[model samples]
Target: MMNDRNVVPERRFSADDSISVVETATGKRVDRRDFLRLTGMGAGALAAPALLSGGRSVAEAAEVSGTVPNLLRNGTYPVGLWVAPPPGETTVARYAEIADAGFTFVTGIDGCGGFCPPGETATAENAALLDAAAANDLDAIVYDHRISNIQNHPSEQWRDVIESILGEYQDFPAFAGFDIRDEPNASAFAQIGGINDILGQLDPGVLGYVNLFPTYASADMLGTPTYQEHLARYVSEARPDFISFDHYMLVGARPTIREDYFYNWVLVRNQALQAGLPSWVFILACEHYGYRLPTDEELLWQVNVSLAYGCKGIQYFTYWTPPLPGFHEALVTVDGQLTPLYYAAKRINNNYLQPVGKQLLPLTSESVAHFGEAQPSMGVEVFSGDEWVDSASGSAAILSRFHDPKRPNQRWLLVANREFESTANTTLTLHHTISAMFEFDTSERRYVPLEKAEPTGPATLAVHLEPGEAKLYRLHANQGD
Candidate 1:
């Protein structure tokens, strides 16, 4: 339901305009030189670099080898939402609705309007929310105002404050962890790390989560010279339970995607993979600012692309619509009615994400490749002959390869349709070493055998992908190799 009238004029930088600059998201103008300095980009390079290759280089500096730790209690791939039901509406029915939509966890349990209301403590509200989540079989990540601003208190009192805040909720079956912070600056990593350390000691079973900013953030906002440094500092200093970040790329009144979308994913995925941790992303679920409300295909596109990048968890930006200017229509309306996005999310969650994500949990990402024209400028490998795949041809797509540590010869490939609005028909030419192939059946929650190609020559399989859809295939390699 995006229209031309919603299109905001594209802000382009000009060489002549050396004195001033227009912000990319907001139209507010600021001093050009100052902006460039803050972003760590030179005047000529105001736009994203042809490639932010530093992050990739850092990832490639060592062999890609790490064990992805399981942080969730239920051992399910996390499908979480940013805002839970408000304090007044924290009922069993509402939580049940979320579970019915296929979410395994809820992140914002302090209150729906982003924080607890006046006179109501986050402890009290979160206790009630946890009870509701327990009733519905969903995990809750409690958000406490004191813990989020732990740095403001004297560093000496950090332990006492954190323990006091998390003590009661740690034992709850529904309690997953605490939302330590979101989009924190690099300067705050030490404090965040201290908090994480304390949580590890006091409640070793719980996760102390903190989500990082995307690559598009200003240098001043990131408190680092480059996005690469920001991620590096966070991992080294914060020592987080898992890596999480948000990058809402499908935007604009006319609904064009951002160039840095895949770049951001590549950086985050590499950082997480290098650290031997799981990565989570906040996918856009609402229309806010100039962002268009996503169609069903766009929603699927975001989830499928995140999976293609080896993401282990999916979080929606907002589950309950925020009652604020420029924000509109999330999965649920402000007054508690379900929006079309609710059903769209339900279909995607139940039909694709849940099953595929669980199946991918025990596997390690080996490599990812792109086929056809219109690929991103960076962080993607061109599809060529691999050990098992001879070649892949046809419509543009992404193929992510994975392998189970216990069964190294068995490979898993997830093929995602790059086009959000159209179908893609691709053909995969397999190497003779691939003895058998099977597709993961989401509905049946099992892998079903794929029809064998002619035995006389190299095997080929035709894959048809709907807009924003992906298919998972497992291949067994011949031991003789």
Candidate 2:
């Protein structure tokens, strides 16, 4: 466990509102302005969160002693990676990289296929995977042992397979659950749901994992009148514990981005919320099948947009590089070298996703609003320009509203930059007085105070958001001074 006192010393603001940051090596005081500029705070506004433990923020680290003390213990949010570990490399370091990046869970197999070395029994493979996961206090989603497409397979056979896998590996402390299938159509739900129920009966904690197809799936392939209908049928038949889906909306194709990209999120999010189930969505980690490689801003946009919709979990499509053609440049290369994305992923997860995801797990998303004409899901209302002091900054952005039962009557706002190519400087003039405002310190995994708005006639909060960056503000008029 990290000791808070040793990390972030309290900030002492200078007369000019320039805060002091102590340099770790020499104990020299660095001006906050210069520190932010150097860290590209204005460029991305990532500095809003006190980069705490394991990432960048000393002050945030000082505050939240153990954001997650036991790695996978306290967290209810499930952050999973579709691992593509290099063939023949099952070292502790390999798995440790996943854990160190703040992912709480790992899928035992790779993308586009199951475990390689087809002769390897899923049971043995899962146990070995568990060994790696356990070493880092992470969990593994048991994948196919020998059976393939068990979800589409006959229900009785699927049960037998699920039972066999669980019987042999369910005892492992690191076993998270079994991956039944990926992107199942509506017709397969009844059988898969039965298998899910059986898997649950075998061990209640083990999830019946089945990721759904996104709205991008053709209407005919969906087998339902609409994508929404497709999901409705799944929930009714499959009886899943939670909902999950994958949409690679960042394809820089004809539209430059998927037209239904934002729509997919809203649809799945609403469906999951209505069913009273938490949902998980995947962000693209590799370029393939016409999807271009993502820049850092694009990556952040994917995550922030998901978070804005109140997703309970964030799943990366690929962690290790896939050996398949066209699917290249994963966080780790097929040859076992680290890719640049590996480090960037490390920063985003530890610095933002994991911490914020954990914090929002229990809260429910009440509503989502998009600012400007470019974003927001289809049919959703866009924020009017009159609502803010200046609309130019947030002309294209995401505004998510949430309700936390733990703090009755309290609401939270998550503001995100819509575009991935530049920064957004938004001056928000609240229609009402906000009690307090704070930025979630990803490093500390706790809420740190934001300076109070100047006492102008209208309470205005000047926000500087980097491309795809998000600012979380807590509203509590009752606690206002």
Candidate 3:
């Protein structure tokens, strides 16, 4: 537990200071020590909430200590590497490198085919892998385990195979969790439910994972509305440990790629948020059949955008370039060297994101407000413009973008250009007295100041955005101040 007095020696930001705490009311009397722990304070920061201690309110205890609630405070999540085995190297070497890469977690199994290593040796192999991860103080998650395509195997057989693997190695310290299948269509959700049932029968302690499409497809098919409904069935009815999804960027998709993706992320994730589930995203680092591999900048965008939308963990597509070449696109080069994307992970994890994680482990929130139509159309509604401005208050504010009261500092705004590749003129006015505005670049993982408007009381700001690009704003101000 954190001590409030020790957490906050003094206020860091103030009215007299250049940066004031902008959103909501000030001096809310937060517990400092708890804040430090929740906000991922300095190394000397207090410890995290003790979980499973006889059903105590871990969040409340941390809050009483002085920590703020879990929100986007700071820090790149501690980065994890998806270990790839070289052409001839045994699984042991792969495990060693995964630990060496500073990744505490490994996803999927070692072999290339659709089956986990067979027979009695499978348990021994799993134990060895667990030993390697533990020795390096790393955590390992076995996802897309060697179950053949559901198209090939019956759901019952799939359940049996998954059950055996879980039963054999449920006690291993290195086992992080299990993702039942890679990508399943709507029809496969039932199989996923069956797998979950089997896993529970074996070891209820381990987490069950499944991947959904990038955007929620309609239940009519696999799109958002329907997918959300189906997902709810599993969550409420099946009650799995955690929910995971595959978020991929097609080759040559859009102008503001990151922005486009972020909105999609928000739409789909908002559903998971409503379900109150911890979410993880599977990012595409490798090139699909004919698609191109993601560049370093694009890779950073995937991680940052997902994190901004509040994904607690990330899953990478391929770590090793397969010996067969044509189908192999990996974060590492063919020779098995770390690609630029690897460094991007290191930088965010070791520095910016890690510090923030120390403070608030971002859990999904139900405080989202949807604007306009869903994706493939205008990603976000153009809220700030000549028509939307308030002439009397001389302020520009979009009521549609306002947040639900449930979230503390739970505010987010989506702004974008009307025309693709065309710069447009727009002004954003704040209904409330404007104190501070910040925009985060998902691709770059940096924040920039939107030049403050010239007029004082009325916040009139000019926005020049390219097509397909959108800005997510974090606004701060006291209510009725």
Candidate 4:
């Protein structure tokens, strides 16, 4: 039987759909596809093109020459944050916090509600924010308030607003793209074609960002699908290159809501997949609407869970905490302090994310197998510099993404953890004999030995994770195969 501790409550499948439970005492197994259906990843989860990056070492170049290439051509995995100003200052200390916290990008308002400094001043203020971010080696993106409800205007008015915003950022490099409409309704999506029509006329290369609500009411109620279905249909037709999603499981009194969170994200990912779009996820950073701040374990669970499922980019809903009397539970405090959430984020970024991105930057996401544990999801057959390592096994294992960054003979395998625990004892027993080194957990980010007990036998690898962690291992083809 799966350990109760590993079985997160909310996403738990019904009794009938339970998977094989090996009674620890009797050594007997029970058959449960219903359980697998509840947890089993459909075939769609397992498909992705893999390739290599432009920069490759000499040994890596000698491996496999060509394979599946990633849809996202180049760049490291980007860690992003929502931009908001401090309560009193046009200048916020969080800009520095983002850098200290080891982030790659920060997104913020150009000045919303007119309370912000006017025109050029606002642009300069935003520019200064970017300048601050750059000092820390972080990129910045601009976000305007909800466009769909701008003046609660009619469709034409909304289209004009979108066009106007796109026009403003046409020449701005510091500005990535507008978030478009935050949590837009069906009307907004249906009218999206027109909005894009306006944007195309103004700035053809700008991206249209959409953050959709988790659930929605449909005409048929019972037969009506969830909002994700609608989102998928819209994105597939719209064909936006990158899609963003917001997951707020803690919004209500759902104490055990973690399981539903991944499913909700997958719902939108399915939409992105059908649309042939790449996806990014926004994880909750603040305690919203009575929702408590996430515990360290829960936070780590969310990050590793996301990487397992295939989120190229990870975004924190709010990096600069909003003040008290409203949203008090924040990832970072108003005093520019690091909360439990902040440290959790640091541990994840420092120990896991960056190192893994360095190794896996060459691979593409090839296929997936999302079953076996509480947060069960795995992507298999990714190439690490042209070396294909077998998929992870056991209840919870590594989530893989493969890529070839235009470097003909090189590839990368982005292997991330599937569970939240700071340490994992699972081993990858490959069919081929090879020696590899991985940077694993605790004190002084050092390289550890990958012990090989035999010459021709499968390699045994054990890892120690620091909460929401990730690591990369590079192996030559002969060593890996």
Candidate 5:
């Protein structure tokens, strides 16, 4: 059984409070000061130190390259929100507002930590929400509390309860999947897997969605020795349709990013590739407890970094802020007003995520190379140079290479600025083998010729990336021509 304390609850912590409390993940009691120190929210930890960079040592490249595959099972590039509009605010207009903000889907509609009224029947509300979503060209994941916890019930009642809960919603065109659970322990894998099996058997078209805990979770919370092991067991035992996890690393008053942020991505990206499954990540959107409100660059940083690491989908945590005490300033206010963060997310989704995500959907991740002063550890490969590219000089950046399965000679490179608070001025030197090059135009949703590049032979292209921005380039290699 999953630990009850592991489930996400409304956190209640103040910066100045020194009272002893139980750390949520470890289940160990500690004073408030210790919790702050462990979470990187202590007084002296104002600036984020580069923990991933050290001695320059190149590791052997892996023999196998992982393909992301076409995992857009819902037929749209997913830009989802965790908390949809509250129950009483469920309207076609409300969903239209969500669509206007460039969100493609909404999850946790019925039960997102007391967002819904007490004693509300989620099945009935979900039906109405689905209708609204379909009208606005959006998808929804059903999150009825009873059905989500189906494993806790008797074995025989699983089918009846599942069918009774999900049977009607399946026919709705906007119905994407069922919200199984969030942040489950390894001990609960068998039960979760059984539920997923039945879900697949009954309806193959719909997905079984479950989000895991981030690398920050303690062994006690994960019920495993390490976060990688936790993910491996989840994939093997749960038999999920896709992998999803939430990592709220951008925290503290001064907004220092956690050290293991990229390390977590390395693990998730590798695991997803190995499983041949698409992966999704939850971007932090709300301010609560130790986490501060995300700035525009910070938000874009999260999305672009996830994309660079080959995540297939994006969901914002708490789109509509929960009514809990510590929670505040989500994309939408609790009273239905839009916030500045909402517009920032809108710009990101429309300008970058949707277009780039669609372009990368059918491509395979060949490798990711880190370039600049600070290189992430945990076996992340450094960019020494490649056959088609001589070097990438100036500014820290992440370069992710992808190739089309049918056309091996064609390649795509996504170069993202590593700095969230500063711009990167980069110069990429292409080798003689690259016959043609182009940049993806987000406005046109197509590739346009690189204005500064030569038609053939070695070429140099200047890349200017804003804070947390990434540019997609398409390359054609000469094949013994």
Candidate 6:
């Protein structure tokens, strides 16, 4: 049962046939090919790939070295914000507020610069931004809006601009990437690819940032027949180190969320899985236009949902509380006061996201399935091999299966409560006997053994989760069962 406090009125979700999900019962389908794909092609054969960067596969390289790695420490995943430039002068005081909010990187609002001086003036401006970021324990994804205008020009001119910006800021340890463009269509892929080529030649370590349009865009807007096709073309042409995009649909006075919300994730998850690329998604942190302030659950919905789909990082649409009107609901206010959303974000990020993210980064996503009322139409795997498993019926949950390439026998499960405004009691039932299983404790920040259970008939692991909360489990197999 849901706590009615913030329960959004029951609404029908959009049906996207391209990404499949099926009801719990198997009777309707004759052959469950898609269902099997959604689960696993039978466990041991599953191979989870590493995130690719600069055309190099992290899984392969990291495994060969035989050392554990973290996304933050390794500088792979960036949980961050879209910040406006400093006010008037080049001061990083805002960065302290950004750092205080627990964001790792600060990306500009537009290409080159946003709310800052133009041209060579930006060179000096970004220097201050990066300096402040590093001093305050944050990273800077330098945005050079200047490059956008001149990328179409001759190589010499473009090179001069790209080099000028990179030259001024590349040495800063806080420098993460150059925000090359935002919400680009297929027409810009070739151009983006050309710019990325220059970036590679200059500094392969830096990410060439170009955020894509969400699935809701029209074919004309995307410059491709379908949204997936748009992503495919960009991946093929741009050779980006990673992919990012934003879609703000949690709207209306009653807080109506668009069905395309989850659909957009499917597109990103499918593509990222195939490309072995990391993915970043943005959530609406501020109120503007028709969209109002998001409840804590709404914020968790985007962040946790992204994690379920294997998103490596998350970003807030605005962290600095832009000077625009009606945008007061963000983490920080225009006057730098903390809003309730800020504290909510802090708890989710520090207490939940940071711990889980650090733990899940090294493990590659093998498969994902959903349960409860809003389940993905494909199907969730409650049973595998001779073992039959069942989750609490009617509890909306997202179950993600992951595997460490180095430890193939070991497996992981990340269960997320999908209902944005309700608490879910999920009982995971396994019909077949197992040696042992454990749950990851985010609070203590370690795995604690779950009391061993024998299958008198079925073994059950029950968990209670707050709205938009998640839990991770580890299953251990005993030999010669």
For 148-230, candidate 1 gives per-residue lDDT tens digits of 66655789999887766655554566776777766776777888899888777665666788887777766766778899999
Worst 10 residues of 2 by lDDT: 1-10
TM-score of 3: 0.58
Q: Which candidate leads in lDDT?
A: 1
Top candidate on TM-score is 1
Query: For candidate 5, lDDT tens digit of each residue in 1-481?
Result: 1222223322222122112233333344444344334332233422222112222111111111111111255356788987677657778999998998889888843422212233334354566778889999888887655555564568998977665555455457677777766677788787779888766655555577888878777677677899999999999999987899888777665447766778888899999999988889998898865567889998998998888888888999878875544566899987889999999999989887889998887677878888885646545778899886789899989888888889878889999998888999998898777777899999999999865456554778698999889999999888873
lDDT per residue for candidate 6 within 1-481, as digits (tens), equals: 1011232211011122111122212123211223222222112221222111243232333334232212233744457876443334235676766666667778742212222233223344455667777888777776554555454357667766676556555457677677766666577788788888776666565677877777666676577899889989999998787888887777776446766777788788888879978788888887754466888988887788888878888999766565433344577776667788888888888778878887777778877766665445432343222332444554767777777877655678787887778898877774354556788988998998887465355557787889878888887655544
Clashes of each: 0, 6, 32, 28, 0, 12
Evaluate all candidate structures by whole-model CA lDDT and list the values in order. 0.74, 0.64, 0.46, 0.48, 0.72, 0.63
Off by over 4 Å in 1: 1-73, 109-122, 253-255
Q: Higher-TM-score candidate among 3 and 4?
A: 4
What is the TM-score of each predicted model, taking all chains together? 0.83, 0.77, 0.58, 0.64, 0.82, 0.78
Q: By TM-score, highest first, what's the ranking?
A: 1, 5, 6, 2, 4, 3
Q: If both were scored by lDDT, which would come out higher, candidate 2 or candidate 4?
A: 2
The residue ranges of model 5 lying beyond 4 angstroms of the native Cα positions read 1-71, 109-122, 253-255, 375-379, 451-457
Per-residue alpha-carbon lDDT of candidate 3 for residues 44-163, written as tens digits (9 for 90 to 100): 311211111222232333333232111111233534544345323335665666655445466544222223223312233334556666676666655333432333455558666665
Could you tell me the C-alpha RMSD of candidate 5 in Å? 12.5
Q: Any residue pairs clashing in model 5, and if so which?
A: none
Candidates sorted by lDDT, best first: 1, 5, 2, 6, 4, 3
What TM-score does candidate 6 reach? 0.78
lDDT measured at residue 310 in model 6 versus the true structure, 0 to 100: 84
* lDDT per residue (tens digit) for residues 3-98 in model 2: 122222111222221122323222445543343333222223212221112332223322442322222235556778875363256667888988
